[model samples]
Target: MPQRSAVSSATETERKYTAADSGSLPDLAGLPRVAGIDVDTVELSAQYYDTADLRLLQSKITLRRREGGDDAGWHVKLPGGVDTRTELHFPLDGAGASSDEPPAELMNLLLGVRRGMPVSLAALLTTSRHRHRLQGSDGTLLAEVVEDDVVAVRGSDGAEVNWREIEVEIAPSAGSHDMATLFEAIEQRLAAGGISRSFSPSKVHRVLGDLLPAAPELAEGARYLRDYLVHELHTLDLSDIAVRRNEPDAVHSMRKASRRIRSAVQTYAADFGLDEALVDELRWFGRRLSPSRDLEVQWERLAERVSEIPVDPYREATKTRIDEYFSAKSETARIEALAALDSQRYLSLLHSLDTLVDELGKTLPARRRKSELNPEKLAQSVAAVAKNVDKRVARVLKADDPHERDERMHRARKGAKRMRYAIEVIAPLHPKRTTRILARFDDFQDMLGEFQDSVVSREHLLDILSEQGHAAESSFGLGILYRLEGEIGRQQAAHLEPAWKKALRSAEKLWA
Candidate 1:
């Protein structure tokens, strides 16, 4: 059986003043009362692990076996807010006990990844750490000493271990000055030891760990298309996590991610092997999630706006209506979105997306070249994405009913974002053209977004009023909010027309 528990503790301390000009430690004058002896020491070697895709490392999990410290052992640092690492300790002899497999407690942390694939033993390193402590204004025990670490890494193949060092810190007090003092003190100490600041960004890199391949160098057309596709896939993955967590704005965020991915994939059909039917299905799923997400954003926005309005004759009534509408809609939308996520189709889509990403990663290498960005090709690609957005918007405009119109409009907003992102990814390649295109796209997206929000808020208000019994006096406020949303929608539509024309023109000039 594995021992599993969380111990909560608070830390507070300050580091002594360091040299003013050198940013190094100064002598401690009237150091505060030390309640306990804290050793300012250094730790040298630490190993890290991850999956083939660098999951654990990306998530900031560190597994290391260290020597030369009083608390040295096998340490698995879990992610949390502060430098407060959940240190799991073991004797040096205990190394082989879990060498072949991860402990059960650690397994829970990697639940998102599939089981049975051996956790890749990625990299090994030696880290040197210097420690320090701080006291309160009065001579009283506040926090313990901190550590500055210098690391040397043995490559994955047991080649050479490159040496680098960084500071691993903890505070005795929450104050920033104390932290700064400790940092200065440690730097001075390390400088005296002939250790300098490491040029490596992270200890993992210093060790020569496996890294994701750099983005392919492609022609302007291919690069824009590739990055656009990659962004969509990335968004989909983000939404998956948000959906699984059931976060407050998860549905909306997930829906946006999905729509963006689908739109981009569809627009750049020649660049990727996505099935049109599959993309259509994803659009359907996004539509299902939109109402709740839209309602949430709308209410939050309108609530703020309404608060700014003076106490007019209808101010109180408007607030009441908006409140009632959102309360009921939020509940219903959440329930529906969760149910949709549980469907087999949704699962299948997720699997398909994962497969698509792998396929793209494999195939893109063949089509790419190592060179500068081509302006004309990038402009053409942006035009393609914008045209896709135009089509989506046209479909939404054709929808007769409010529900259908709102749903399609949400999809259009996603299409606009993808178009925007496509231009953004290649902005470096064709700075002038991409900038102008992005600016216009942003305006179009903002208006559509506002319209969607109003639609969602109104729905939520209606739901609330319905549930609370729609008596004239009881639910009168909901009606006012709904009316306000309708007005807002009209205004948003009026604003969007000229923005669309400008964006279309920008794309054409570049493409031409």
Candidate 2:
């Protein structure tokens, strides 16, 4: 059975001196000295351990076991600040015992990495430690000191090695500058002892132990796609936390992450498991969040731009117009968006994403063997995405009424965006052909984006007016903005027709 005990902190004091300076020893100065016995100031050896998932690397955790030292044990060091390491110790004897792994208290610190994986013994290091300490102005507690260790290495094979080194670690209270001062003093003393600073940072190369194998290489494209997805996922998680805490801009950040992930899915569908229908659904959520995000961006942009207007008349008018526009109906739309995100539908989408990620992780590794982006295959994929977008657009055009048209158009914009992202991915492989497709897609998307932004802004302005008890004022401005937005949409639609025709011609020519 293994027993647990808390290691008490002790105050230490010592001074480092070189062999040449040993003849001119300074008096105790009211502190005791601790010295090593018959230990040559040479180099040492050690090896570090981490999980295959790289969780420990991400968290900056260092796990090592050392030999040839009076205090050889399992050392788990968690990152503190710039210069501090929160070191935890476990006796070497219980390392093989099932009950002797790192304490349960450290589980949370490990995150999810060590949950099921067995901790294997990694390396053996031999070290000799010379300990010391520094005192405060009144001889009270200040900082402990350490001078270490020479000659460390790995492997069981008996072979001669050449490396020499020393290290000085100060107590946390000593501060960075104080630590630098102590290091300089120690170096000067070691110089007198006929010992110089080792060229290497660690003594590990001097010891003998079994060498660890290098990590296997992953498929380049797949790895790039996965890294991008992981970053977006982490951003989404952070945004969720910010929203829960009611932080400013949290909703906007969350929406952006959702959009980016949705884009990635469409872009890398060949590499990852992405269903066109499912991606459309995710885009629907992104569309719902867009109104809030757009309003936020426009407000900030307009404010910055309007501030630079040299004429007071132009500046005041622009500011008033912008303020009145945003003040209308803005609260209601923001509230609705937030409520939608909190709804069961949104949560279901999030849960689905989690499941998708897990499934992809399992299948992606196996599919690495078949990973290739042939131009013919890519052209077919692009055409397929374009066809999907056309279908959605047709539905919007077929709607009989304005309200239905608006809803369908919104859906169509999402489809167009998905197709556009698909083209973006293929652009790298078939630049000229993909460029033509993307150009058409862009024109269509920009028009739809404009239409949606107008609708959202009009709604917001009305809400703000209603809140201010100026419904009439709000209505008049909303009407003007609405009409203007309609004109913009009509203009865009007219331009897109020619662009789409050109795109089709180009796609056929290139693929032919």
Per-model TM-score versus the true fold = 0.66, 0.46
**Model 1 Cα lDDT, one tens digit per residue, 287-384:** 78877777677778767656444445455666666676678877788778767766666767766666665555454343454322344544566677
Q: What is the RMSD, in Å, between candidate 2 and the native fold over all Cα?
A: 13.1
Residue 408 Cα positional deviation in candidate 2, in Å, after optimal superposition: 4.8
The count of residue-pair clashes in candidate 2 stands at: 35
Q: Which residue ranges in model 1 land beyond 4 Å of their true spot?
A: 1-38, 42-49, 58-128, 134-164, 168-208, 211-220, 224-255, 272-292, 302-375, 385-415, 468-473
For 460-505, candidate 2 gives per-residue lDDT tens digits of: 4455445544444334544454456556555654454455455555
Candidate 2 is scored at a TM of: 0.46
lDDT of each: 0.58, 0.52
